[model samples]
Target: MHFRHQTLSSALAMMASLACLSPLQAQTTGAQAPVISQSDAQHLTAAPSKLTLLTLLEAAWSRQPEAQSYTERLRAAESLRAASSAWTADSPAMLLQGKTDRPGSGAGSREVEVGVALPLWLPGQSQRATALSHAQILALQGSMKAQRLQLAGLVREGWWQTQRTQTELALAQTRVANAQQIALDVARRVKAGDLARADQHQAEGAVAQAESAVAEAQGAYEASLHALRGLTGLLDLSPDNLEATSEGDVSTPLPSADALASDAPSVDEHPLFAEAMAQQSMASAQADLAASSRRASPELTVLTTRSRGQTGDPYQQSITVGLRVPFGTGARADARQAEALAAAQEAQAMTLQMRARLQAQAASALARLRSAHTQWQATHRQAQLAQESKNFFDKSFRLGETDLPTRLRIEQEAVQAQKALSRARIDVSAAWSAWWQALGELPKP
Candidate 1:
């Protein structure tokens, strides 16, 4: 009874598995199954501890639509590579022509020819096929590299955006707190006849304005988190404290421009360029195949036949050497070959142009990084001075030595200084990202 119960349960599970494998769902790739909207999936996963830049990149690689596309392309290339190396069979053929004799009164007969052939070896066919397959493998690797770099850049940028929003939100909250304290003091002074009712009203207006700014900042912060979570597949992203001190030896001493340029590979080696080159190579191979189709190849043929005419001698056998010559497609083969050569030349030229463009972009990105680093140092010093000034003004205001307008002005200056500092950090981070992209190093493990 126990065994029977277990068997029944196994059957039920098998049925459930079959049901889950719906035709429509089965059609989609596993990688494509993660198509749930960012908002919907956000709740499904727990927030990770200390989510680093690499972790975010990995998540994007797993979930992004472009990743799926590259993966599918790689699979297709592999399948094609296998097909190119395998043997294939052609068609069966037969022929018959005869006339029947009626009771020995009259008789008529005619001869007929029939044959069957298969490819033995076509010149340049195997070499061209192997080269095309190798090219495709290299092309697919290049595409995968490109996709990884893109995902890394996106994740880093999203991380910075979220950080910046959090910084802004915190600053806004500080302003609101200060404004509230000032409002309370003015209201007390008005009740004690030390300040006018108009001053109290101005303080109240300032408080209201600060509150509105806080609300706006909070909204922006939340939006940034949502955007980040969409990319990283991490839902509960919250603002964390940023590093206050700069790490030592932040500068990267780069090699000479000539040296760097010399290290760069040719256009055919770059991912997109290589893919295009591979495609052109494949086209050329296909044209060669078409040309080969016009030539005849030797094949050993053997046939066994059952003749219906003679009752005693029904069995017959024959052996022959067979060949096939393409009758009409040779001219078309030349035309296709010419077309392929033109396409290959075009791809080569495009690759050269792309390499030039990529080099220029790399140079620009490096220059930008240097400029951003210098600017950030200056901005950091300015922020420090602004903070000191705000502190001085705050003390004076508390001692009744400074007016409300003067205090507000100092606070605004400090706020602007902090914002500039944040922007400078953001700029430096962006420059680093661009530099990585130019070097094709963003997706490196």
Candidate 2:
């Protein structure tokens, strides 16, 4: 028994390990193609503990006015769906009448009739009801999907902006340090009678300029952080809480246009598209129901009545059947049916149009990603070249082979090149974000 228990424990441990590792492995292998990761993972000063994308999504879902409005509409649709199952109700009704006439003879007559109007087997009622219920569910699903997509895009935008600003801030700080060192060197040279007072003034001016630029960049960074906080609803979001990671490869050549179009609307497998399709089905069902408005199912009703007369017993028992068929002056049924059909047709057309648009959107996103990646590569190379130039110019200036102004210019150019490279990296990230949004994916925390 002890050995068996040990075996069971070992099996459980293995299972737990598998469970933990499987998802991470899948993420790395592209088995589940999630959105790109940002730097949040590497720089987290503290675990969010209870914070998660789900928590944020839920909060937004609850607070958003559009989501709330749609929820009410969804409830109403559900009520209608329930009503469709049992469309007819039965009740007994009573009637009384009395009359007297003057002359040679007078007579009075009264009758009570209890009847019920029963709806017959509706031609398309059952199917229509089912379709409507399904459609409503789909519509709600779509609304939720749309809300989440919007939120995800916003979060990614904020995240990328914050990262970009932080990178710029670092570049700006480096510029300040370089300028300070140059000023110090010039000051020492002037004291040693190797450099003139004019050169010292130029170095001091460059230091002040670098300081101002750093201050501006810092302000921009702070503003970006503020935006990130607002968008994510996390007051404590900072560079310390983020991890830096790349979007890997966005440069895989895309498939042909024909191939892309072929899979266009197939993404209806997506929840939103599925919901839209369901709504179209419901509209079709509604059209059928309107066309068959004049039809009803058979009904059975029982009734008991009481009556009073001059010379007879006043109690009566009876069973009655009632039937009603609407005969409108115009083609009301036809008109209603036509309206539903039109709605369904419109929904179908929109779905097709959206599919075409989605394909175009995806293509555009991919193109941007390619452009951003190329830009990043070029800018990175340029920064390297600038660094080399700055190093050469610095040594030349120190050896009295180059003037102070020329060295300062080289340093400034190097700073610009570094800033450009940082900006390009951020652009690449933003392009990946756009691609993710287009594909209906969200970055995981």
Candidate 3:
């Protein structure tokens, strides 16, 4: 009795799977996916811990050497800012002099002097240098933000792809199980003189094909999982609820094209846009500092000397002050200034380009989101129609009215419809993720 119930359960499961497998679903790439290694499969099954896309990005941030390098540059810029003041422009220099002479007559004469020379900051030079340092720091901050945003996009896409392959694998496995049941049932009927030998053979061939498809889907899924792990830098990885969420149904209809159009222009205000502006500011500040530094600072030296001679000779004292200023060469100074000015102009051009690029990115993302959502709706309807057709074929097969080959054909179509619907749902989520990323919704991580 227990064995009979188990067999009945398997048959019922197969019935449902065949009915759901529409042609569109069957047309997905799982059967044609590249075969991965056994080791890869083993590596993927080690579900270490639950992880979300956000957490993955944060982990990636800690491991980003480029971001760290930029941070170090920012630190150096801070030091430069501290050194931009007039007092820090150059260290005070001390001058010392000593002399001793033995005259043909009385005593040896000795004199010692100490003097300090200080470089004076030109009126606007200190402020200009400080501003330059500040601008560099701002640029570094903006660059870090852009780097992180780019990293987040890669990881996000990887995560969604993993979900895609994983879901497809399950669907493939279901098809394999259903085909096996059909083969078994047909073989039993043939032995009992209820079905023809040709029917049994055809059903057996389907099971073989379905098993091969399962292997391909498994390999593709494991490969995708490995890629996700490589990007996140985790010792071990696990997928969270992204697959479920992405494949799940939406409660409301997607937005209209006009709404998306209205929202597209706002992505220019993303953090990446700010980064380009910061780069421009840094270049402009560099130009300002170069112009200010053209005028060299003057040095002032103050000295005092005292001498003693004979047993009770009065002490002799002298004081001296000197000022020096060196003129800058015109060719070199002008060239230096021109270089900075050119950099400023280049940076300004890049800033404008970045704004346009971001706006375009946002528009593209919005369009994809809408298209995917619409595809999901259309494919879902196809799936339902396929299901109804599969139901009619299922009834016909059970009554021995439809041959095994005809029934198998209908089942394959139903599976394709299932696959198409699943892919459409996954694409919708993927499009939404992309839209958010393009708009610089990637936070600090």
Candidate 4:
């Protein structure tokens, strides 16, 4: 699987390089006709190039709002972390006061005071706050990783869907070419008076059917391509772009099912699991901080006062220091602590659920990959036998030993068998992609 995956990566890179060339360059090099229709080429040309898996993943990531906001989120977490390290629990405030008794005795009496109020952190609260900030950073990083993995799954699905449709289109085109050839042969036989006119009509009808199938396949292929382009913001309509080799075609021996089962990584390592764990840690830290913060922060006040009695009296300055301890609001603290604890418990439960889901997905994907391998082998044999049978029937038909209906039936069977083989090959690649997705692995460059 690894070898085949690398082969596919190389193929995609090569195709992307080719796609980067101008039409004039392609024409000068005498490139073959594009696999896609002219309309598709026109539509795709408007999109950016570089359609490799990694490029596609990047393009998709760039479009995500969360990805765009990640830097700001990180900055905010860092700011909180810095704040937690400060000596003061909150910002300091300045206080000013002035008093006069001019309306009363008229014997000038005035007082002016200035003060600074500094908030203090409760014991253990600062450390808990720092822990929460650290957890916030970890949680954000984990969330980003999980988000990228989710996007990788989307890209994988779109990539394989496009491959499947392209395969169908290619097979449909081949069927049309074969049908046209058969029609020509039937016409020749009719002209020589060796075959009836009805045979020619039947052959032409087959050609029409094949053409219709090609048209349908083309539409489906274009739609899938468009959807992929939407995700990756890239389009390379080159024929070689569809030539990625499937795992079934690789000569590398696959690992045994038991080996696959044992190769599964621990669920704790998964991005979703990590994100849930981080969230739980953050919530726990928050609960701890809340528990320590039983009341509003205590404030230390330092004041300087100047007073004068009568206009000629000289001012006096004195410094006074005082401490203000807020009364504890047990109900508010209880509510906040309860909320944080509840959040922690919820996050823990989510972590367990995420682990279970990942394990199940990994197991299911592995089983499907194994099944796809088996199916590919059977389909490969079926296609080979169908081809041989088609060859025999073609010879017998030309020799006037086989009826037109029998020849047509053989052709249909051959085409179906070829289609199945192509689909099976694509399925193998798709299964591998899905397995990687289940394991939270992104496509490598």
Candidate 5:
């Protein structure tokens, strides 16, 4: 009980804090937000415990309006089978008639009759209607699934972006520490007359520049985090919640498409395809129902009649049978059948269109992944070369063999190379994410 109370209080506090922040400030933090450890990925403060990507996705799914709408519609559709009459008329109706004669002749007479009629269904109309409702419910289920896939896509995109931001912030902090250390070393060298005063000044300038970079990186990270929160409607989401890739993160080398091909789900497993199939079935079912409706079904009625005869006349009681059939000129039936056929045709066309769109999307994402993977490899090589060049320049500068400008240029190249490499790796990861989405293989809530 105490633990639950504590958790509630903590959540309330967090909400209060969030409420205090304006939308603008959410993106550009005026106060320091919680720091994330890119190394361990643990939250740096006391926060909601045991939050995971799956849990967050589930929470967001519950909040999604479209998903909820389809879910409700499915339930309603399911209930329709019961709402529909198993037979055409749920109950029987009563029929009564009476007649009276005035004293035009020697005797006056009065008579009355009472009867009951029971309605019935056609041969198979009741069953067909029930089946049609079930088909509609199935289509609604597929629609709900498609909506969930959309939500999952959003989560994946935001997850990768947050991963990139976390890595960038870490890199920026490391750069700042390195710059500060170099500045202190230069100061000592200048004091010992081993380096020029201008060298020390340049080192200090680099330290200041690094500090500014850290601030900028921090801002970008905060913005990305805010965007993720808005997208998922889960403010407690963090880097640790996401599934770590095989190499551990967006910065790591990911498996090639060929490596994953064997385990990859086929395009037929996609939600778009499933949804289209369901809709096509629903339209076809509707057409069947319309065609069946063309055969007119009339109610079956059973009745008992009671008659009171006039004075001096014999008492007579007899049962009268009747048939009621709805007659149509086939015009209405043709119009309805034609309308249903048109709808089925439209649904078939839409299914084809969706397949074409998915195929195009899959192809585009695959091409991007291949190109981005190659570029990431090239950037990795570039970083290695830049690191070696920076080392050579550092040694020469320390020995007074390289000018300050030359040394500064080499350091800048190394820093830019690292940044470029980070961006390329992120691109590859994002492209892979898109590929997965294109295949409609999103992780379910």
Candidate 6:
């Protein structure tokens, strides 16, 4: 009976010792921890150190059709500008005429004429055309910037989505590891007759739940990575190369609230607003050109005629000059003028609409950034309290003062708090990206 009493005391002491071991210490026993498959392990590798937001933006921009066509569009606009600077409104024409009267008079009588006609630009037409071409160039430039900013928004969205899923996956993996360690301890205790078989089953259930979460988080992470790769056209992107700072490591600080509030760029400086204004200017120039061009371009003709009155008469040559002025067709001119005027008015309205929309977007983005920062601070505090609670429960369970269910609940709460904290960090980064986007700025290196 004394020997049996000593054995029970030794078993109790062993259970107590195991219970005091922290999760990290328990994880050090390689053979007891559940094995993570190679595929899951690969997805959990450390982030690539060299990748940056600017690099992703450049990669995504390279794949865009608009980015490729920007140079061509600029060249076309320059050609229009060059054409507008020429002396003639249209190309010069060469005219020729010849006549013979040999059949009726039996006389060698003929006339030949050759002339050149030069089309003249109406007053101020060239200047207006030049102005229109300049406006087109400005509009193209603004449009390109706008397109790049739009693409930046997409990259930011994909990048942050990837970060969010990756954080979840990391947390899920940690949970799995912790649950597996607990299960191993519970199984040992059950075999030693210190814990019931039902407790072992409960521990195993927790492990299974954690593993299920890993599967779900893994799927989400892979999907987010694929979307980012599609946008960037980069097939070899590392899953862990995140733009946002990692948990517990803030190497790069977030923008301050004062900076965010005071550094709002002017709405007129935005590409969308500039593009709209350029369009309005171009339309106004078009209207002016149309108003000046009330009639077809007049032509000045210079000719040379060679003729003979009779068969015996010597051939004669003479030079002639004339002007050809076309009459103004009031109906056609009126229609064209009215169309140009309508386009100008429409462009004016659009510019006003664009300005208002950009201002609203900027305001919305600022609000979101502020809200995200507030949430991040709250989550940080919640995570700290949850961690403290978990530590308390961990010690209590080790001393036999707490049950398995209570300890598990505390662990879960801690994990949930950690998840919220990670999400909040990512949200703050994403909001800043969105704020830059709203201001028509691309992601900086």
Best by lDDT: 4
Better of 1 and 4 by TM-score: 4
lDDT of 3: 0.75
lDDT per residue for candidate 3 within 123-152, as digits (tens), equals: 688898888888888878877888888988
lDDT against the true structure, each candidate: 0.62, 0.63, 0.75, 0.78, 0.70, 0.78
TM-score computed on alpha carbons, candidate 1: 0.74
Model 1: residue 418 alpha-carbon error in angstroms: 0.9
Can you write out model 6's per-residue Cα lDDT over 319-388, one digit (the tens) per residue?
9999889999899999999999999999999999998899889878878877887898999999999999
Clashing pairs in 5: none
Off by over 4 Å in 4: 1-50, 103-107, 235-250
RMSD of each: 15.7, 14.8, 6.2, 9.1, 10.8, 7.5
Clashes of 3: 18
Candidate 2 runs further than 4 Å off:
1-78, 87-121, 245-266, 270-272, 294-303, 329-334
For candidate 2, give the lDDT of residue 78. 78
Candidates ranked, most accurate by TM-score first: 4, 6, 3, 1, 2, 5
Provide the global lDDT of candidate 4 against the true structure.
Answer: 0.78
For candidate 2, give the lDDT. Answer: 0.63
Which of candidates 2 and 5 is the stronger one according to TM-score?
A: 2
1-445: candidate 5 lDDT, tens digit per residue? 3553354345445435545654233323323665545543431222245444455557667667876677577678877867554555356678777666754553556556677766666556677678778888878888888988888778777767776776676666556555665665576677788888788778878977977887887787778877766565554554444444521234545445663356556656789888998999889888888887875667666555554456677656777788877775498899999999899999999998988898788778778887888898899999999999999988987787887778778888888889889888878877877877887876533
Best by TM-score: 4
Mark the 10 consecutive residues where model 5 has the least summed lDDT: 39-48
Lowest lDDT sum, 10 consecutive residues, model 6, at 25-34
Model 5 TM: 0.72
Provide the TM-score for each candidate, comma-separated.
0.74, 0.74, 0.81, 0.86, 0.72, 0.83
What TM-score does candidate 6 get on C-alpha atoms? 0.83
Clashing pairs in 1: none
lDDT of 4 by residue, 295-404 (tens): 99999999999999887799889999999999999898889889988988888898889888988898888888888889999999999999999999999988889988
Per-residue lDDT of 195-282 in model 2, one digit per residue for the tens?
A: 9988878887887797687677667767876565445445454444455553433344433445445643346655445556666666
